[model samples]
Target chain A: MNLEGLRVMGIDPGLTRCGLSVVQAGRGRAVLPVAVGVVRTPSGDDLALRLLRLSRAVGEWMDEYRPDVVAVERVFERGNVSTVMHTAHAVGVLILAAAERGVPVHMYTPSEVKKAVSGNGRADKKQMTAMITRILGLSEPPKPADAADALALAVCHCWRAPMLFRQRAGLIDGRVSAAKRRTPSPDNHDRSFPS
Target chain B: MNLEGLRVMGIDPGLTRCGLSVVQAGRGRAVLPVAVGVVRTPSGDDLALRLLRLSRAVGEWMDEYRPDVVAVERVFERGNVSTVMHTAHAVGVLILAAAERGVPVHMYTPSEVKKAVSGNGRADKKQMTAMITRILGLSEPPKPADAADALALAVCHCWRAPMLFRQRAGLIDGRVSAAKRRTPSPDNHDRSFPS
Candidate 1:
């Protein structure tokens, strides 16, 4: 299928709830929900394993849905440094999920998604929900509707520039194998994914 | 729970078959299987996400079973660097699972576990399995016996002291936390765990 019609998985990573939504990517905005839910990690597990589990949970979604694109929430203004660190760790879990699949990911800020859906950069959850319901032609809002917001983000991203996301992430199959070969591995921190 | 009375989750980390076993701690030896099996990460997902999925799979195991401790296979070989790296990564996922639950971990080298299980330090898989059967008083061997071996390693680590292992790693938890705080996040790495 072409970029405009590919499957998209939208995600909103959070501490208590990691929101997730999968939607069909047809041109007529015929979005269908493939899956939606949250993965819960108890307070007892370490942060690392929790993040790992979060990523894995999403991977299971990928396996079942086989989405061609992943659109995730960009870093919002975390209230505390500690919270930011936690959110960043969660973001890591997310990026790893898509990066490993060799699937192209398009990141959208909460503001951008808000603007796209509600025509305001600072749309409230209610507004976003209302707009999402209106746009998707649904009676009730999506389940765990926060997850639906993530799906909306993914749909928005694909709508923004489907082909551009793929090209930047280098998902063209060995298009940058040589470049990836030079990407450092092991205890080193520097990474060289094709952008 | 006291270390001696707690149930332990033993992990044998690998790319494809991550051996999972559970053992109970007691005066003499009372390790038993709580749950044992493989949770496959379907292909086409990202590598990091696979690790995340591994963590989640093992996390589910821990949640369902509530093991008090986790025992992991330590890295000692040098020839297979890439495999070792991935093994370390995979182990990280499992370890993170244990950590999220605040479950203490006891890591042992393959040889050390082998030595503890068999009288010989360099015992092979068959020898290790035999010892495991004898110790557990089982007529038939555990199914998918890698799980059995993992339990044996956990049993050994729990029973044995680690004066030497401590001398080498020097308070693994404290050092790791300090190092993470000091170092900048790796560019491409998604730190799956939070401090």
Candidate 2:
């Protein structure tokens, strides 16, 4: 699978501030950042209105950028139930916007994203930001932690999507692919998917 | 402030099975059931696909019924974190669908629905189901719990929406309105605005 010229939008879903990043990547070439921004919704508004704002913003981004694929941060176990619910709600809107535009959606867990960008599953926020800055050749890490996480997610997808397609196509054995061989030996995002 | 003849679609958001019910209500008539059904999404499918299915279904219902307003059951604090997340995600999709069509969306809590329908804030499922069957003049309660809950939510909105409008219009004072005077003196759904 030649993944070159593939455009992907990575979304870190949050009700207050959702991070969105677009990256272009393929094999044997440096990934490039196309766009990075955050969609902010006022916490004082009604819940439905807050979600509607997110949905519209995501839809606008998809229409303007027209990415081939969308990668969203998978919501995982968290201490704040309200935060988890809000994140999941935002994620659904993101996925719906992409799906409505006939784009494929993939979810990557935080651990997988951290490991892919920083080579450590338990990497802290600062470590993840530093790695994303270096990976994208940016002068500095993106603003508001969420933006950096979104870029990391986009990069992770670019690095991992090809192997997933190959696995699905039965072109490679279930053990490992050439791309995995070149990358760090850590837990992969596409592995044990649909979490 | 005349909320009569308002058609409303009530939604009970769930990933596996989303219950949607439509009801017609006016100032001086019995609240009538317009439609009742459930939209089921296989748990085996991708999360995005499931939500897209739900989004499409809700969109279709909005187009066919053209409800003036949409009422969604607000997801509340629950022991099961995953369930709460899924419910909130589904609720987001429901609200987005309605909002896209220029429909007003409102949220009602479970206790409010129970009190509005059964005059008991802590009404059990069976008791609520019995009340719904009696109120809707149906032979029996709608099957699959979710469907019945959806109908209950719709009825709850029909009874509560009028007072909300009156309050917003300043036609009613701070004291409980005449409509609420007839019902239980428990907490009202619209009193707090949003949970």
Candidate 3:
């Protein structure tokens, strides 16, 4: 897969404030920032309404940026259960927006993103902000940690895209060979792809 | 609010299998079943794809059944963290679908559903199924524990609608009067409703 000119949208999902960033891969290891912002929803709103607002915001970003791939921060079970659940909800809507537009999506854990951006799995917010500011050549650090996290997620995916693509390709090839052994028909090859 | 002929759709959100059921509130405490089924997505599919499929399935149900309100089982952070996160994802998309169609969404805990259906907060699956079968006057119990749970959720919402409506109305009235006291402008009345 060609990585040149590839655009990626990264999302840090949260019900109250979802962070979104769009980054384009330039020549070599250079990455250009396209957009970075947060989608805020009032906590007083109903859950359904809040989710709907979040979905529309993400959908608008997908339409405006037309990113080739979307990267989302994988939520974990730690911290407050209610907060985690809300974050998971935001993730669902964000991912669905990408799928609806037929854009490929990739998810990375917090540790993976931290390691990719700062070379440390346990890097704190300040370190992450500093690294991202230096990497992006921005005059000021990204404000509201969520925005910085989104940028980090996009950078992480841009760096890992080649490896992930190769891994998927390898899996597809293995599945195709296994299918050929079971049946000598071309139709069986389609089974390799998830429906 | 008139309870007669009110339609309610209950969703038991899950990634692999999402159960959906539609029930109409009849005279008094009688409730009639309109539809019952489960939407199944293969685990092999990507999370985004699965979520998109779930969202579509629920959206189709909402269009076909035209439910006045949607009731979803409130997911808790228990058991496997991954499973809970998936369930929360399902819940988010499901709620967004309802909100997109302007249908109000309500959530109930597992215990609330059980108590409403079987008068026992700790009612087991068998008891809940039996109670639902009897209450709906169905020839047979709804198959798949998810379907039965969906039906119970719908029935629970139907029974609780009157109280819930009253509570919401009271809250709105109180907010409106409080807003009037703060600023006697009529335009501020809109603030009482969630934007």
Candidate 4:
């Protein structure tokens, strides 16, 4: 797989509803969505059963998609404690699935996901939906908010992959020059929804 | 493997410190301690890396011990949300490992463990330790509290397994006659430590 043209699977992890999306990204070109879906486990089920359901779903996706990289939303302590705990469990299962399959995994903070997709770190849900729909050339934002978040993460990972790849390869010197310090790139320009 | 003589692996799950104990129990005899240890992962490591460390450790135990059944303490809500989250993640990895290996898995609540080990459902740590040491014919209780909890769980499962097996096999009469209900067997009168 060319580092420039990578297949990425992004996950918005949760126990009740886990969002998963796969995208093919190429240099200087729009991304192509390969698949977008959510895995649902009933809330009343045992936690162990719920995790097992997620593990199987994730394992199946990995085997079928053969993604070069898998990205998951980092679990933060913003929501209800129970919700955060469940999300952490889901993320753990996803990470284990990817790790066992030998697929590289990355975690994107929620703010970073928003910034990558909408060009604003604090982009609201409406702005995020609009930008992702336009970016993916979808008729509308992906069904359900979680799917949109997952697609946004995939797009974000693709956009940032080169910098990450460079850093990982110990080639960051060429990418980070003295002049680029403390200056925001023009590529980060945010556009308003055409209202 | 004889059904009457079963080996069990009990886990007290935690991300940083997972306690493991193996015990063998046979009909009308004292439960024997097979092994006891803890899997430690550094808190400074990435969550995924920590989980991977646990997964490998659990896999190693499962292979080396080959217990007839693997039991894990059910994750319960308590002190800190973060602590519960980490424990849930640890338990999920363990359950997945056992499920993948075709090993039977059981979950015992903390109260049930204490009740089975000691007569009281809410036995304190000191009481539980004394009971387990006496029950297992050990000179002293297992160290580090976590190991004791694990051994308690394993012994509890063994003590309860016969009743569970009978219930599952439809051995007991449908009515559970008065003659079968009230008499405590002579073998169960282990009063060395007192009730």
The candidates' DockQ values read: 0.08, 0.54, 0.69, 0.31
User: Highest lDDT: which candidate?
Assistant: 3
lDDT measured at residue B122 in model 4 versus the true structure, 0 to 100: 91
Cα lDDT tens digits, model 3, B1-195, are 669999999999899999999999988778899999999999898898999999998999999999999999999988988888889988989989999999999999999888777778898999889989988989999999999999999998988787666556757788765655587444222112111
Error of 4 at B184 (Å): 16
Q: Compose the digit string of candidate 4's lDDT tens values, residues B2-84.
A: 34568899999999889999999855646889898889999998777788889999999999998888878877566686777
True-contact fraction per candidate equals: 0.11, 0.65, 0.95, 0.32
Better of 1 and 3 by DockQ: 3
Candidate number achieving the greatest DockQ relative to the actual structure: 3
Give the lowest summed-lDDT range of ten residues in model 3 chain B. B186-195
Candidate 3 lDDT over A24-61, as tens digits, reads: 98765677899999999999988888999999989999
Considering the two chains of model 1, state its CAPRI-style docking category. Answer: incorrect
Candidate 4 docks with a DockQ of: 0.31
Which CAPRI tier for candidate 4?
acceptable
Query: How does model 2 do on interface RMSD, in angstroms?
Result: 2.0
Worst-scoring 10-residue span by lDDT in model 4 chain B = B186-195
